[model samples]
Target: MATADAALRDTFTLQGVTAVQPRRPDGGFDWDWRGPRNDPEWAWFFNRHLVFTDLLAAYQQTGDVRYRDRILVTLDDWIAQHPAPSGITFSAAWRPLEAARRVMESWIPIYAALRDDPAAFPPERRARFVASIRDHALHLRNHHAFSGNHLITEMLALTRLGLTFSDLPDAAGWRSYALDRLARAYEDQVYPDGAHKELSSHYQRVVALNYQELLDLLRASGQEEAVREWEPRVHRLWDYFAAIMKPDGTNPLNNDSDTESVAALLRQYAPHIRIPEQTVRLPWAGQVIFRSRAAAAADAAGVRGSGFGVQGSANAAAANNAKPRTRNPKPAAATPPPLLYAFFDTGPRGTDHDHADFLHVSLSVGASDFLVDNGRYTYTPGAFRDYFAGPSGHNVLLLDGLGPDQGPRAVTAAADAAGVQGSGFRVQGSDSRFPSPAGNPKPETLNPEPAASAAPAVEIAWGDTTFASASRPAFAANPRAADWRRLVAHVPGRAWIVVDRVITFSPATLTTLWHWSPECTVEPVPGQPDSLIVSRSSATLHVRHAASQPVPADRQQITARSRPSPQGWYSPRFNMLEPASCTQLDQAIRAPLVNVWLFSPAALPGASIRISADHRIVVQLDPATSLTLDPEAPGKSAVTGTMR
Candidate 1:
């Protein structure tokens, strides 16, 4: 049997594009590997030289002369074409930092593997490589990004390069400056509860991996004090992953995130840190996860892998059972099943790369994701980019057909207005200029009023009933017009309840949207205009709404448009998008508006809801249990009563 490292070496593949495949050294080389590809951005990323790591690994495992020769030839060609402090590699500000970082990371292992082979890494060629690393590191030291992940990546690369070349005259200064910046990044970037302030799961993983790599280098170099100081923060970062990771090992596609899994991170680092098995709520991070007890029990029994570990046995069993069988399967147990997994987000108005998806929720059952966040496809400025990063891509309320404000600046403006409005109780008139209902408002024209009440606040409680609540200004333009409060509750073995309440001072329009996977189908319940059935595979969800007046049939519709519309779209990967089912319900709001949705594996029986004159809500989920909510006095509102 092949060793684990050997197996990994055998399965090496470069970035999915085959256009830049390196050729053998025939006394001549092509430094410009992109050839005639028109995509400059793709070529830029490809030419970063990260893929050389694969060649290094292959040569180390198999002792292949071809792989070793190719590495030297490519390095020689690159150095000859782009000298120190010049050429496209060093001239572009972004490329130099990234190229310096990737080159250091990819070349270190190869240099280590071939250090003894004088023929492969002759002293002159080795000096050239060292000079290139010095130039790249000096360039990064001179130029710095403003903040966020870019700064983090650049500093991390410098730290690694400094440690690797510690014998150099200025290496100590480089290490000190890089470590100081890293410490500041740790304080500013990672939230108190381990969430990356940028609020992107994809970038969270990226940042975590960068930290882990730095720590590993520290440990290898006997820097115990540095490792000790940084270990806990790295563990906190992984804990966030353990909390929000879905049943399928992926995470919620929060804010500029892709459909990437945390399994690889866990697989690499699980042995070093402690992994949590129970549910957790990261209050500071504005995230809450409701884990299934049944799943936990199975995981404890070793029937299912824990903490994002690979399930090799389960995969083998599945592969063995691929063929159809005539035998009858055993009946399922009669006990109540576990509640589906649920993730809630009510974080701060995110940073630059973050999306405006406040109070968004994602749910999954077994291995299938039901309600999902429209993932970020690309950073390119266009219709798709705007939609994925806006409020319409999430499961939230769009008041008067308008999404939330864009970023921290907009959020601060709204909060300041709310402070003034609350002190004076002023209401803006209809003549007040607001954004167009089309959902695209010019930056200069966006002056959303503050809510008459207050800014959004989130509360979480766990036990028999796991739930989280967020109360916030629903509309940026007409913040004083209405206040929105959302509650998400997970009742194990029963159902998941999503309650949305909007209290308005004047007439307004409320559009509640739910985005599901492309595989799901939705339809209105027969003879029940207030309810809809959303089904995907074996799971189903029943959504209901309570309004002051009857809803017209035209206002409730399901769409799966491929265009860049707000109603229906899904992006599974970067640079790719497809149509997905989006169920929308539009209702006219005069007084307090309450809408409830119940999700279950089995069909849910009909329930009754009553709203008192004082805006209190009574919902009978089943014959045995009832829930009462009074928005006016939230502390005293949540009561469980028996249905008579």
Candidate 2:
């Protein structure tokens, strides 16, 4: 390894070094490994550390005085703003001490590089840096105990520093402790299926960043054997990361994913490990490790394999369901949509991380989002600035219009997990429900899972009374609408919707809320049966079962176009149930009431119904109906009357 003093001797050679910045859409330069922009809170350390680390690497690689000078200028800026009582420095710029620890680690290399260049870093700057480092380490070793990622980073820095200041036993102890913590953290935080608990893209980047440091530390310390030992585990993590990526190169962006450059970083590692250029489509453990290992082998052999770690190897593992240590074989599709489902139980009442979308589920069909989770709006203004992050952002009830309170204190540990089908996932929480119409405040739980193994479908089980039934409604507008007009003469035509769940309703009158928002005008197409055209948008409603023949215009009466107030669009919770007679009401008391919403268009005089188990029909009567759904009901029973 090149010593910092050796590189410092050749500072003049730094003149011609060319840096290839991360690319941008507009062709500008960005240094972000994942992308140009990132969350200010998290990216604070990431960017600062990146610039500092690059400078440190440059100085170390080329003995560049200019690089050390640039780093000192930035370090001084931080020192001036955060001078402590001991003339050290600290920063409140980020939350969760884990973030600060990263900033701490970035300085170790900078210090080593800077200490070698006397002219570039003065005594005062070095003193300040040391003071800050020791203070932070002291606090971390005492106060910050829950930091998983921070422990690894801080331990590495201490280990590096310990080599120089041989008297520090704490540094070595910290390193030992970090290794144990890492194994446990990896076991718990990283699922057996390799899914991350946070599911945030930013966190994925952080994981990569953490691993890079560990790999760098191992490599620099002449511990390549450790890297070889860890190669499989790291490969599994990378494989997990690759599996969650969408075909379009974007992650699902669920949870707290703000960074967009993760795809680029993954590409960078692909060549090193020999992952193919195409998107991965398999669901297996340690895929990234396998691909990387395969890459290493192929690069060494200078040839590709027919069945060894190739891209799109789905059936590879299908033939082997036996336990581990069994010899494994290799295998191999699509413009498949990004279909994901998430459920929030515990009623969005936990910490700021918690969302008030208990019993809420969202679907993304094709590229468009349906029943969406209103993506996060802002992070600085607490959590209330974005109404969508509140209960209103979901398809479920807003609960007497009361959203979760956004206060100063942090809310944590509000989610619970249950495994389904090995790869199946369920996260539940306490206090997950809101007040029902009957004034009963029940705790809601959101239970969501993939509808099938390796399919583009998800089943969300919302254990809340409010989500009794849900149906996706589709409508076609006749004569469409005039260009540039917000209001259009919409000739309502009927389409079919497939309801996945049986309507949970009491023996009373059942009402359905036909809610539409995006603020488009809804015009009632008079005389057309099974039709209503929204002026600004097009809609398609699918029926799960039961076909309807198009009723002629002469047969219908009211052209009821409802314009709901305050929010510009319509959210008409239309009551569609007939009052059951007293005699029959008792019989229907406990059984679920399912409703099929079918609209007919005149052009196709006969309405053709196509049903998949894909539609939603949320009933409104009994809040407890969901708990009673027969576990033995066939998937088809979720929807009846197939007429496609």
Candidate 3:
């Protein structure tokens, strides 16, 4: 019987089809075996040849001749089946680019493993391998993606291949073109604040890994000048990941982000970068992290209690829970005041990979995620895709069942009229909301063109143990008929207060959506019309809302049911979806809409939220700590005593 590793190396399994037969001796493989050429799953499976690298690793580890033979056979089969400019590989621009990257990344290590052993990889085989790599580079150089990470990956692959095979006849031209394109992509796709234009933390990690490999290749080739030129930008990219990572070493699924990808990148690159041990704020990226000092102290004490050894309770706990929390309780907390990590997205509606989620926040206590962004399940365009990328999947204000401006495309006419082009125009429409006139216009009167939504003007502040950010009237779907402002403040180890204030001139329904991790259970607080108790093991999140208008008990709903209309589903990885606890607060807009969320480790000592007629919010987290927030002046919150 074949070992598990041997089986994996010998065959490619995808979409539940294990041990798929390889190509015929004549070198013809089934490109579209399951169904139509437009099958989304087939497209996804075809592009993800990541297993090729796995096979190479297995061969290196076990010195397995079977794995090496499999690699050679597969490479030869693919090259023969996908001849230059004629096969499925070159039919679509994206597929070819993806194949090029996968091939380049897979071939390098395999070549290294077999370099010294001429019998394993003879001169003829090496020549064939070089020819195949050259073809990939040439194909990528000619076909570029429309934008986003696709183009970036293509350029990175080209550059790596050119540098690796610098002795080839066309290597210099490929190297030069790839280098120029990569530089431009860094400037265009990376924000000045170090955030990727894609806005998805997962994609940010992808871009980072691509650049890290590029730098490694350049440095190996003695290209110090090139390495220096790109190092700072790459470091900034790492900084964004460092700032957004949670206590569990994963990032919030703010857009189409896969939790697994985020965790993998953190594991791969975190040690090489200079990540601060405490709180961090990236104002330009509109992100902030508040690390609990108490949590750190407790972790330190837990290690000491475990004999002060290298393998302490902290390490054991981390090791036990290394896989992303699927449907289990988090490892036991080290002590009181568990690590609190929260991410607030107040920046632009990033590139195509980003969802229309503005002012959406994700919260976690220790290793367990509580409130989370609905993750990207698949890129296939359908109802699921729309819901995942729309406001329904996020924790934000949904007015009259409509999300932020998610029309087919942004209205560039207004920017063109203003004589602005490129980024100046793009920045003008970052808010993802359609502009409204000053008075209430009938729904039919609203137009998608000439007046688009303006980007939210944001203000952020970071203190020793507190972080605060506010967005002003960012959503105006109808011309001035409604105004929305989101204020988020976090006091590490204590609580997080999010206040959503909406003022409307017309009759509208306001719904606040909160999506929690699938492991959490949510229920309405007994006898409380506007509160919910979300419990996950020992940790609990106390949610309380106070509004000037009447809020009925029937307005609150907690469901883990999946529906076609994006209500209660969480996708931690691509192509997988699970039911999650989704809490919605529905209220009629008569006066200002104010909803408050207070998240903590356990039931609070004194949990009461009062909204005065004058629009001032008073929140009491405990006997000694209380906050008075003036909605009109979010930055001027008065604190009675120190909770820390």
Candidate 4:
């Protein structure tokens, strides 16, 4: 056996240790050094584990004796605060214990380097660290938190324990169990299309970190057989992350989101495991496209030199020397496909685990999201808080402020009546319908039906191209809500259409205008009872009812105060005519009005009518307006454009 001097030969000094906060120069880092907890205790614990892991790594890499001594003290402190016998340490949602176990086992290398040096340390201190490892491991197994947060950590603990203590009879059995659990977790946790359930880019990075750690350990132990088997699975996880990244470099916060430390992990591992940019479409997990398959393959193949994959591989090798080198290199992944997707919500009130939107849908063209569902704002308030569960946050109606009748104002019903499932996207089957206003004289009246279904069943078909068809229901939400009645606020609702054309089939009642303005501002044109307009740079001109027409005067009252909008403000402006010429607009491509330019106060002149070379008549809406041709009026050439 080597003497203490020889055992310490491999130790390296830590440099950044002195600059870290909440840590003594002697090496102890505070677990709760950042701030007070605002999240659940379990989540807080998870955060704490990160701090602990970093501190431990600093100690191990620096080989600073002070760092080791500090780790011992910190471990003692943690053990005292979280006693294993109490059952509370592993209870509830806590995950730090799992991390604690893994870190303890990793210390085996340090201990083995000193095991023969009886004079270097007191017997009691050495025994404490060793005993702590076993205790934490047992606690993790008891809590079942091991596999839930990526089974990699627990697997490391088991493998390290087995390697360090060969004499223990249970070590062999535990190793087998750990290995099997890992395989099962991988199969179960990854979605059918390889998306992570947590869906957060940060969480994927975390999973990748754990995977690299496990793979390194396996290789070091001469378990190349197992490492080879896991190569593709590991690559797929990275691919999943790359696929979900948005064009803006942000990953949509679908599940748990922790932006902190994500960039660091990406920088650390991205180079080694360059995930391929292959398109992976999972309609169920809300990932319409994934373009990181290539990067993943590079990482799995352990390609080195030149690319991001090489950097990660070098880091992995440097971080742990136990891994055996492999020659397998992943081939480049295929080019990603142009992914278009739409999300539909059939669930009621969206308070249930699976719901919050009854008729909300978001559409994505490639990486750009066009129509979007405003994602979660706050997590507390039990997921149904007003901001996350309100009509304003979604593409649905507020229904006179009497939205879907969930149980309490604070609590919403989780109703998922129907939904669509496909390879690349999912849409909710909605029974949400509204009557065609053609026959109803009072189409703008606010009527409530408790037993009414607002969603409609729609059919989608994809071949060389794609098309979606849905029979119009008796009712639909008004795009301009407040216009139907005066004093009553109008909430805008939207629906998605994929075909080249959208035909209303029936002569649909209610005004339809394609609106385009970055800052959407819809207001009644002053004095014009039936006409209203919305503008971003310009204005959308709308006329709800003509003065000559007998309209519901009770519903048409002007507001006393004006609301501020992007272009300007709207005050109590009335029309010059007693009743404006509120012409019923049909087959008309209307554009919202725009101030010609910064210098030109001239309003948008109506679009120039043109006949195409092919003899098709074309009516262009104002540039500010993203108008939809009257789907009810078929065979008419109508087009609208909105500025990006």
Candidate whose TM-score is highest = 3
415-468: candidate 4 lDDT, tens digit per residue:
121333333322332222322111111211111122233222222211111111
Clashes of each: 0, 57, 4, 65
lDDT of each: 0.60, 0.34, 0.62, 0.35
lDDT of 2 by residue, 1-644 (tens): 13233323322111112222343465322323322223343333333444566567766677756767766764665555443333222333323243345445566556655576567656876677767665545554444435444444554444444444445546666556555665565555543333344444456556656666666666777788777765555555554455544322444433334425434656665324322222121111111100011111111222322222112222112223334553663321221211221122222222224344433333221122223334343454533323324544443332113322222112222222221112222222111111111111111101122223221111212222232122211102212111000000011111212222223222222222232323223344466433444322222222122211121112111122222311112111111111110000011112243323332111232333332233322211112211112211322123122211
Write model 1 residue lDDT over 97-172, tens digit each, in one string.
Answer: 5565555566676777787899887899989988877877786777657578878888888887788888888898
Q: Return the clash pairs for model 1, or none.
A: none
Candidate 1 regions with alpha-carbon error over 4 angstroms: 1-41, 58-69, 84-97, 271-279, 292-336, 406-481, 504-508, 551-560, 564-567, 588-592, 639-644
Q: Rank order by TM-score, top first? A: 3, 1, 2, 4
> For candidate 4, what is the TM-score?
0.47
Position 482, candidate 4: lDDT = 23
Which of the predicted structures, 3 or 4, would earn the higher lDDT when compared with the native? 3
What local lDDT score does residue 461 receive in model 4, on the 0 to 100 scale?
18
Residues forming the 10-long window of minimal summed lDDT in candidate 1: 427-436
Worst lDDT run of 10 residues, candidate 3, spans: 462-471
TM-score: model 2 vs. ground truth: 0.49
User: Against the true structure, candidate 2 has what lDDT?
Assistant: 0.34
Rank order (by lDDT, best first): 3, 1, 4, 2
lDDT of 3 by residue, 1-644 (tens): 13326444444555434445344456555544432324445534544455666666677678877766766776666666665663334342237556565656666666767767887678887787778777777778886675788888888888877877779999899989988888898877876546777778878877888888888878888889988887777776776775666766667887778775344464566545433334454434444555542322334343321111111223212564556656776665544334566777655566768787866778876666888998988677887888788888898877667654422222212222122223322211121122222222222222222223321222223111101112223333444445566777665446677777777655566788888999888887788756677776535566776665565423545554545465788888876788887887777665556666666554564678888777788888778878777666665666777665
The regions of model 4 sitting more than 4 angstroms off are: 1-69, 80-83, 86-121, 150-168, 260-280, 284-286, 289-644
> Which residue segments of model 2 deviate by more than 4 Å?
1-74, 77-106, 145-170, 219-229, 259-262, 270-352, 357-372, 381-388, 395-644
